[model samples]
Target: MGLSVENSVTQSHTRTHKTFLITNYMLLGAASACIFLTLSLRLLPSLCGFFLILLHVVTIASAVSGCSIVTSGSNKSYAAHMVAMVLTSIFQGSVSVLILTRTSDFLGYLKSYVREEEGETILKLAGGLCVAVFCLEWVVLGLAFVLRYYAFVEGQSAHPRNERVSEEELKNWPWPFQV
Candidate 1:
């Protein structure tokens, strides 16, 4: 029975790991697509264009870093990953709303060389993708938290509760710190 329970836990962990990888890959592709769509508007040379592309670049970077966060033992790395994901998700959502609601004004700001109608269409498509990226970022954040929980559980299990610290070992501690 114990063996079966361990096997089930391993299977659950494997499934979660796979889902995490798949979501990150989808996020990368969506972010890349948004960059291409932005370029299609011929806004690459403008300041607004530069920042738009930079935002997607940062999203891609965060997603890439997320893949390794599970194996990294440092608390700092986990905290940084959480911060990046939250910021990117917020920015992506705001951009999508702006693109969808104020298409013409946004195009004027971007100084896009494309015709008004074409630019609006492209912006809408990119906005839709931004929404996807935003949702995926949050999903990835949740999965990362779950993975960390699993790691903590496994680590605790490794040190059996049946083993007690000997009194002699306990007495060797620094004076005030002794339990």
Candidate 2:
């Protein structure tokens, strides 16, 4: 019975890990697409354009780092991943909303070399990709949390530290703290 339970847990963990990986991959693709769309606007000389591209690059880096950190299984790595994902998710959502709602104004700010209509079209496409990236970032964050929890549980079960305390060891504790 115990073996079966352990096996089931392992299977579940495996499935969750796979899902986490797939979501991160999707995020990478979406970010890349956003970069390409931004490039299509031919606004690389503009500060706004540079920052937009930088944002997508950061998103891609976060996703890549997330994939690498899974194997390290360190609390610090998990915290970093969570922080990166949250920030990127927020930024991506904001960018998408801005592009979708104020396409003309944003294009003017970008100083895109393309014609107005074409620039708007590209911005909308990038905005759609940003939305996809935003959603995928959150999903990745959730999956990372789940994977961390599973790792913690498995670690505890595999090498439990809750051994029975000896009588002498227990007696050394302060009265109120005695187990």
Candidate 3:
């Protein structure tokens, strides 16, 4: 009987620890991807880059919300998710102004290198795509908010930490497959 109890407790702790790690990994991946995409914006035209930038913004917001939800309790999750969504919406939406300004300033240069009508159409389409992306992000953020709120209100707390790693100890974490 003692052995069985010990086994069960061990299994429970393992599961809790694994869940925490997975959630943390997800948030970190999202944030990293956003930063990478944001830095690559210079490779594309202003309009196209603007659309990509919005995607990065959405990814960053999602990452922040996910990290908050995983680390804090449900109440904090809802608050964090809401805040990230609002900030992303405002910042992402306004970023179109930069796109417009940049494109306008560079119009003459672009015209000299390409056909005017074709370039105009491409620019228009790119602008349209930017708007579409922003709208989609807004909708997704709303759904995430709702889901987070539902989860929070249900008293569903994640498993307790099974072990502790001091901040200083993190420096010794093994590289992938090295441990």
Leading candidate by TM-score? 1
**TM-score order of candidates, top first:** 1, 2, 3
Q: Which portions of model 1 show Cα errors greater than 4 Å? A: 160-162, 166-179
lDDT of 3 at 71: 34
User: Which wins on TM-score, candidate 1 or candidate 3?
Assistant: 1
- lDDT against true structure, model 3: 0.51
C-alpha RMSD between model 3 and the true structure = 14.3
Judge candidate 2 against the unseen true structure and give its global Cα lDDT, from 0 to 1: 0.90
Summarize candidate 1's per-residue lDDT along 1-179 as a digit string, tens digits: 99999999999998998999999999999999999999999997789889999999999999999899865557899889889999999999999999999999999999999999999999999999999999999999999999989988998999988998898988998888677
The alpha-carbon lDDT assigned to residue 50 of candidate 1 equals 92
TM-score of 3: 0.40
Tell me the tens digit of each residue's lDDT in model 2 across 50-142.
Answer: 999999999999899998686464778778878988998899999999999999999999999899998999999999999999999989988
For model 3, what is the alpha-carbon lDDT of residue 155?
Answer: 38
In TM-score terms, candidate 1 sits at 0.90
Whole-model alpha-carbon lDDT for candidate 1: 0.93
Candidates 1 and 3, the one with greater lDDT: 1
Structure candidate 2, residue pairs in collision? none
